[model samples]
Target: MAGKRTNSNLAGELLIELRRDDAVPLHRQIEASIRAGVRSGRLPLGSSLPPTRAIAADLGVSRGVIVEAYQQLVAEGYLTSRPGGYTQVAIGPEPAAEPVRTEPKRVPRIDFGYGRADVSSFPRAAWLRSIRRVLTEAPNDRFGYLNGRGVPELHDAIADYLNRVRGTSADPGDVVICNGYAQGVSLLVQVLVRSGAKRLAVEDPSADDDVRPVAVAAGLEVVGIPVDRDGVRVDALDRTDADALVLTPSHQWPTGGVLSAESRAAVLKWAGDRGALVIEDDYDAEYRYDRAPIGAMQGLAPDRVVYAGTASKTLAPGLRLAWLVVPRRLVGDVVQAKVAADRGSPVIDQLTFADFLSRGEFDRHLRRMRPVYRRRRDVLLEALRDRTPGLEPAGIAAGLHLVAWLPDDLSETAVVETAARRGLGVYGVGPYRMSGGGPGGLIFGYSTLSERTITDGIAMLAEVIDEVRAG
Candidate 1:
């Protein structure tokens, strides 16, 4: 019934006038008018035309004439109709610009880049069950904007889990749930800047690629300390005037070096003496392949160290759940920062995670994943050892990846490029390095790839290395 108008009003809106003297049939004139309307944008896409009976009465023609014209336009792709739905303009007469075709790039067969987890193993069934339980039993108050710190249940769960598992001195009040480690770092940087802090130090070869840029954005200068076989060089701490330092002591990222007891103690003593803060990023602490991994550094001096952990490593990163064990003194400022930043993370996810943790489901998931990841790590290390004797693979003790240090003759770029040509993807730590240069190395992540794929990929890489050597 659209455009239900008198004879005079119909001509301006639909712009259709039967040309009897021109020898054109009435149906053809109607069809031509509609076609012109579509091309001129008069009847834009999704616009409904008048019903057949209404238009036929206005034009003093039979309804079959209008129907025939509409049917022809529909067949020509200018109109569309659905079952029990309105007949609307389907497309413009002139089609959209077609994208130009170019040569398609080939995808790599095997990738060993860092920061990837075995997401295929995500606990979908268990998570769904937990979500169902939360939805069915959670109180009405749980969904409201009750706390800026996070859901109390999640706060308690995270604090208790950290104290018991990571050996950190955490209390429910001192925990703050964040979107992820990225937001946690940003919030910490903001809080530190407000406290008159100006400079920060990070490990030279850590896997955390965002901390330096985040710190610089907050107007803090970053100084990279060199990492040796025994973790960071603590003796060099006296040389720089850093307000704080971020350390991955449990299992140092990329380099795979554990902070020796001497360096650990030295760093703590230096922090205490210099009145500096230490942010301990417990990245991938749960997947330690060897014997039990080292405890968190925050346990040594809770007042001076801020412990940060995320579910992104254990669970899927898409979950966006992370927690920080703030010192009692800094709790107020940290919570204020969280309030300014998104208020708080989603409540339902927090509650579901709380339920997941309280039921010991998280522990079970980690236990199931450890052995699987260990086997993959072992396979990667064994293959690299047999195939590429020149490349030395280190840091196989813990975490998801191992660092293969290339000989001085082979650059990181050469190994990576040669491997790519053979359908293998490998990463270099050069991007992670700061001004202080470190030995060239490739980081191999094996958390997601299968054993057969790992073996074949490493074999192919061996062939590529041989070709590189031959040339």
Candidate 2:
């Protein structure tokens, strides 16, 4: 209802006319009011006219007068009748001054808009050194028709890396490289839906709006299962009907909470019982600051879990490389979908990345970045704590971004708008949101920030908060 008094949410508030003194004919008054509203551009062409009852109630006019006015307008080509809906303003009478299309561009002041790893913070020195060594040793044909899943070197490397770092037991051959987490999720969703699956369970307050949207578009129903501090609650999962469940077990988005052991066990048990699949998104495994890195949940229940990970958070998002470890049964369908989609991922980047992974360059770069990012995270924490007394950011456990909660009266979008006015770039934890009682906050990514920028940005944010409070 925010567009204009002209129209809002297609639920119009009409201006009608009636008479107490009888100075004017009632139908004539109504006609004049309608014409005035239309000519003033307050009532645009094709806007639904108010129901006769509504016009009568608002103006204290008889329905007959309003109906007569509408009928007159229709005959005059100002209004058009519909089967069961309100009378529409005729299309022909629109003024040239009123533009039909106007959509403003969005540029975030402090675009914390997406929860992604900042690649500019990447350890260039280590990566280049690894790339140099890899180039020297790599064979020429390594560039051609490599594994449809991934380059063999990187696939082997990822398997070894996951086993060592994430404790996943997935074989190298089982992993298929994708464009990103969303790509893998989309493909998997397609395969499942094609197999006659209908509803899929997902975290009620999870990130990744794209996943559910793809499912719904594919004629699959997405049921939101409640999530809590311990991650997706098993007891709360609706058992009515769902063929699969998507979860972020390592660190939940928006509100960062690792899945508890009991919940993990319960979910796995549920999936096992129903012959369902669990998609485990290990988005930010290496960014752990407070606890030991949680290994892949796929290791515990290999057949039931489809493990997905991405370079987006680890190395850089723009690289757009992700991989999924699926069950043996679904692997053929997923591979077919992969080939059918893009005829395989970009070969050069895959080979170069494979070279990067094997030479221990990925690890070395991670080592260099860890302390630097940790320091930046500390700066963010110190600034927020100092400037805003009671502000609390959730999910500091891992990842490039953290969510900072505002007071109940303040909204996340309002804070975002105010920040943009101040020329800062930031965003919510996810474009993803919930209907009720979801935490209200902004996603503050400190990785792309310099020491100077983090300090100045937080100070400016604090100032905006003060102004908003006073205003």
Query: Candidate 1's residue-wise lDDT over 342-376, tens digit each?
Result: 88889999999999999999999998999999999
* Model 1 CA deviation exceeding 4 Å by range: 1-106
The segments of candidate 2 whose C-alpha lies over 4 angstroms from its true place after superposition are 1-109, 123-143, 238-240, 429-431
Per-residue lDDT of 150-259 in model 2, one digit per residue for the tens?
67777787888888888888888788889998899999998998899988888877775768889889998888777766677788774636899988888887567789
Steric overlap count per candidate? 0, 9
Best by lDDT: 1
lDDT of 2 at 283: 85
